[model samples]
Target: MLAPTTVPMPGLPERVRIYEVGPRDGLQNEAAVVPVAVKAELVTRLVGAGLRTVEVTSFVRPDLVPQLADAEELWAGLARSPGVRYPVLVPNVRGLDRALAAGVEEIAVFGSATESFAQRNLGRSVEESLTMFAPVVATAREHGVPVRAYLSMCFGDPWEGEVPPERVADVAARLMALGCTELSLGDTIGVATAGHVQALLDALAEVGLGVERLAVHFHDTYGQALANTLAALQRGITTVDAAAGGLGGCPFARSASGNLATEDLVWFLHGLGIDTGVDLPALVATSTWLAAHLGRPSPSRAVRALAHQPSPS
Candidate 1:
């Protein structure tokens, strides 16, 4: 496992938090439901590799996302790692109830920045979905739970072309208004480029949402996820969302592809001397093992290269 040369970037954060979404977002879109034990192992391996924040599973309707139907079972049986945060996605109050029952410490709500995605994903208009999340956020807050808001389709929509930055900002502000401590801007369709990434961050700043409250989630559909991420990092964003082995896509959006690979992200960050506290070889090996379970090769370039690298003479 060869490492990248360190060329420290100017004006970058000393440390970047990689929000590992492999367990939840990565598995949700799988055609086959992974066993609860395997899911638990994945989280255990990721935590072992130094991902402090891992989204373990989603509390969505079981029938809707059968792949994560064992969320409760998995969470109950998962080995808790000290100093690590395990967050779950709760769609509405019912989902929040299940999460609360499992003693979830952190929760994230999914919202759409466009009406088309709102209807398609959440079965409601943008405002109606927000109305639905209101009680969920309120209840979680009452339980002393911190909320994270995921805003999908922030850049472009497959059905609706080019979403406006101002529109995204408005929806993001409303979601944050619901008491979400962090907001992750999602490039759901993977149509966003580096310029689009900065523009949206600028728009959010205009609406008083600073980079401190922001994280970025990008898909590699157009091979832009890493570049878009770099642009966001340049804008002072310290949190990034990535999935191991580049495992998942939007179940609702047919064009959506796998997320930014955690391995690839780590390689790029390490090259620039940014600390992610992740062990490169351990992370690659984890993705490699998980890929074997899925019966496919990993989509991450770094994983493929590192996992198959020749031993040094």
Candidate 2:
């Protein structure tokens, strides 16, 4: 029998919450039309694997993201478990209105640290897009629903090469001040390295933003998600966002790959004795299920490995 595991680093969070974005961010980029029933079932399986925070779907306009057009249907059919939080992405006041009407308990807003990306993705400057969300954040806070702000292209932008760490921190600080309870710094193009991740966190610290109120969202375009996650963890970050089966990529970011695979992140965290509360075998099974629906193999190495793992008698 193998010996019990111990964390190599001290002062790390005993338990890290795996922010599962499979049902939302993962499927958002799928060209195939995913049924509401399938989306609901995916969320159920993820929660069964002990995922506390699952992004169920997005409230983006149907014309913009037809993949999640059945957001209301999915939410209605979702299995509700005590203590599990199902948050959805809401891009504007209209999205927020629909989410609130559906009884959403938490919501996420998207933005960018770079002006060029902001203009291209959201059709406004970084500052202008931010100003538009002030009322949305305030209204959400009024109803006691927690808000998570996402800053895309935190590390690198396709149009803007090498985003400054301080610029990333500035946008993050602004989001926090806008009544967002937490900020999810997104490596949208997935060009971040371990050193860049560390430097960004350090810059946030310098601006009085503690790791407790921050999360990291990474992609595996260059296969740096796991390494970047470790760097963020070492800096006291407790929340990380990932997509099951490595599904989804940024449509606005050119030549980008899928988001970091939840299975890969789980394997790394469990090996470090960092509790993510995710059952690896079950999580992998969920990914496999979705892969069949997508008619493609999961891009996650851990999912592929676990699917082929021999069952013990």
Q: Pick the candidate with the highest lDDT.
A: 1
lDDT of 2 by residue, 168-286 (tens): 89988888899999999999988999999999999999998999999999999999999999899989999999998899887677667899999988888887888887888888888
Q: Tens digit of lDDT per residue, candidate 1, span 89-132?
A: 99999999999999999999999999999999999999999999
Stretches of candidate 1 off by over 4 Å are none
Error of 1 at 190 (Å): 0.4
TM-score, predicted candidate 2 vs. hidden true structure: 0.96
* Candidate 2 deviant stretches above 4 angstroms: 1-7
lDDT of 1: 0.94
TM-scores of all models?
Answer: 0.99, 0.96
In Å, residue 78's CA in model 1 sits off its true spot by 0.4
Once model 2 is optimally superposed onto the true structure by TM-score, how far is the C-alpha of residue 148 displaced, in angstroms?
Answer: 0.3
